[model samples]
Target: MAEAQEDEKVGGFLGWIERTGNKLPDPVVIFFYLALVLIAISVVCALAGLTALHPTQVNADGNPLVVMSQSLLSGENIAKFWVEMTKTFSHFHPLGYVLVVMLGAGVAERSGLFGAAMRAALGNAPKVILTPMVALIAMIANHAADAAYVVMIPLAGIMFHAAGRHPIAGIAAAFAGVSGGFSANILPGQLDVLLFGITEIAVEGSQLDPSWTMNVAGNWWFIFVLTFIYLPVIWYVTDKIIEPRLAKTPFSNTASADESVQDPSAKLSSNEKKGLNRAGLALLLVVGVWLVMTFGPGTPLIDEPACPAAVEAEGQCAAVQRLAPFFKSLVGGFMVLFLGAGWAYGSAVGTVKNHRDLVSMMAEGMRDMGYYLVLAFAAAHFVALFNWSNLGLIFAIHGAAGIEASGLPLPIAMGLIVLLSATLNLFVGSASAKWALLAPVLVPMLMLLGVSPEGATAIYRVGDGATNIITPLMVYFPLVLVFARRWSKDFGLGSLTAMMIPYSVWMLVTGLLLVVLWVFLGLDLGPAAPIAYSLPGN
Candidate 1:
């Protein structure tokens, strides 16, 4: 009854959000509409002579170059759009990155390696530390991508039930870590590749820093720290807040006899054990290969020979330039790791008898991405249209100017960015889609204000993650609700949203504080990625 009152209270605001959000069109349709709006706006801005002083470019007179907004509705732009439509979608920066990663991820997930690995991590955890253990594994399981939601959430519920705790508490902890801590993983994964790929495009389009390139590990340290920060947050929220609230909520045993037969406490079978062993070996072998390629023989991943003589004469090549190849190679490296590990594990467990099965798994993964492909097409055109119109850069320059004139501290400015991202997440759930729309403006705007693109990306991630669990718009929110319903039949959408509210609030606060601290300390975002950026001439 207390839980009912609590749900009603929180549901008022979130209910409005859910209703309004459901009324909106699909993300792909949203992109198409946004593109149409951008065209109209571009026509108006161009006719009104909107322009900005280019930050990096100079005229023949050595003055800052003045850039005029171009109308996307113009004959030239319309022609270009029609001619380049295919190229735009095909060359979309994140398209290949996500597809490539999903190929390997599909095999690993289908072969049951990802599920077994998550189960193994939480299988024997002590009751005393079960919340933290679930939190930790949930964060790490982000490498499994969307599979984490399917495998970990229910498994956590079962594990908690077996431990005599409220299963909802377990589900909350796992959901918090999986979605709320989405970007807080120890190792760089597909999200890094996807977001940073967008960041790279934004930076290049802005022409803010010609030297800036995408580093998949650019947020390694930030996310590594975030993992620890979120671990305690989830642990405390689960044990101290959510569990107490859920304690009186009666759990209805909804499982069938066959479903109940698969006890989570049961030990792994011999085949599962053998598969895990082989998977570990295969993973290590992949790492070993990357290590040798990076550090041995000619050091192929390093570009010492390509160092400019001006820098080489000073002693060594710039670290970032030298290690560029290694960073670019990590995308493929991760694919190989998942592919090899899954294949090895599947072979040991009889999931993969030959190459045909492996190919089938890869194809299945691609099939899962059909929706993303359609969304990507619309998003690619929208982004390309924005870039061609020159409005993204114009707005960024003007926005940066306004921010600078306000005399706001950089940390405060970044905190606002995080807030903006969190608020937007309630409305727009796809991280890549939101980033696609925001990056061209936010990345370049922050860059103009002396914040690194990486810094902007990092903060955006923090905001994007914190509100995911509470937002009905998030693609997997319904799936998570279904998982919760299995343990408690009365668990409605409001119940799930209310249960996750504390996690969302705490995570957003914690993440904002961390971003502020990171900016004030001037810490590196990742290897060779700083929190501060400067225009080249500056």
Candidate 2:
């Protein structure tokens, strides 16, 4: 009776969250509402004469330390707002980065390369290792962009059925890895670029060292560890928890062969095999070209300072940095890489017949980004207004002071940030949107606690991603439900949420624990990305 009642209590709680989450406006609408709220707050703060001493402005010509917080309603600021609206949307960092990366990714996805790769991954896997294989591949699919969802989720179901296991189990595991383990990629992908791009803007005037660069590869090592950890989490959840529950109520297949959903048991065509081989060669060639550019002949990608004479005299040029070229080339390099590999595969398979078809595929990728574009328009303006008001920096300063005075150890402080981000994720479904809003305050706030921007962003990803599988507000949640319905008509939102809650809870707990351990151990997050940071004087 106690066990049954406990299960009832769990169901009741998750039902409430699903209902509440569904009632909230779209993430884009929420940002608009928040922007209006921010404007109102800015007005009140400005009228009340609120201000913060600009931390970095202390030595600027011996000027006044106080940065008078400006009102969004102030006439001068109002004029700049209207004038820079277009510029704001265009300059929104994630907007361009995601778009450019998607352009090359579009061809790969549209050309059938991503699907062929998924089949090849699962087609030969031993049933014993299938769960981990799916989980690991899902993490790697982060690079394939939206193909992770469109290709991976359903294919997982199909593959599992062929292996004599419950198909819904595969769906759950793949979804967990794809969405819950979003940041667990072995290499930097579009998400890293998108998040760190915001981190750069967040640190604009807040950082003591103006020369510090926010590398997209900053979380590379940390995420590599996360992928291995999450692999077992998904494997355990799918087998020990999800599959057992599913065994009690086996999945029904009422459809005939003709009605089957894409024939999950079908073999890959010969053309796909050739396309895969060619895609592999194309990827290698692209890497070779980049390596040649990076390490051969004057290290062209290094962007060595034009002031070699000054460097020779002074031993260093203060302004010029070697990494600028490499960082700047990431977007273009990826664009070319995706374009080349995708076009090669598509041409081999005849999905892309000519250059024009490849162009169309790229355009399709842009068209698919329509929703994000809309969100970016609102988000760009919101970020811009916040910067103009200087409220973010003020909040960071006071928040940092408060957290420091609270005397939380560095690991504990980092854990709290992860919890805060996780709580916020329940309401906000867009990862980029959440980071864009939170990074401005959270990045600088943690930097004061001796945490690097990459470290803070890594914490945010743990919370944001862990809850993705369980949240109804996640755009893909409904899609996952539809996939579930394929095998079990009895599955509802409550059922789906309940099934995912364990994975969510476990991922968040273990992910945060790993983060805490990593912070205490002082592990390097990525190339030149440390677990701790110090401001210029500190």
Q: Per-residue lDDT tens digits of candidate 2, residues 264-287?
A: 356778888888889899989998
Query: Which residue runs of candidate 1 sit more than 4 Å off their true CA positions?
Result: 1-11, 253-262, 308-310, 313-317
Per-candidate clashes, comma-separated: 0, 0
Evaluate all candidate structures by whole-model CA lDDT and list the values in order.
0.90, 0.82
**Highest-scoring model, lDDT:** 1
The candidate 2 region of ten consecutive residues with least summed lDDT is 255-264
Error of 2 at 430 (Å): 0.7
Task: Tell me the deviation in Å of residue 77 in model 1.
Answer: 0.6
Cα lDDT tens digits for candidate 1, 22-141: 899999999989998999999999999999999889999999999899999889999999999899989998999989988998999999899888877888899889999999999999
Enumerate residue pairs that collide in model 1. Answer: none
Error of 2 at 45 (Å): 1.7
Off by over 4 Å in 2: 1-11, 59-64, 205-209, 254-260, 263-265, 306-320
TM-score, every prediction: 0.96, 0.93
CA shift of 538, model 1, Å? 1.7
Q: What RMSD does each model have against the real structure?
A: 2.6, 3.8
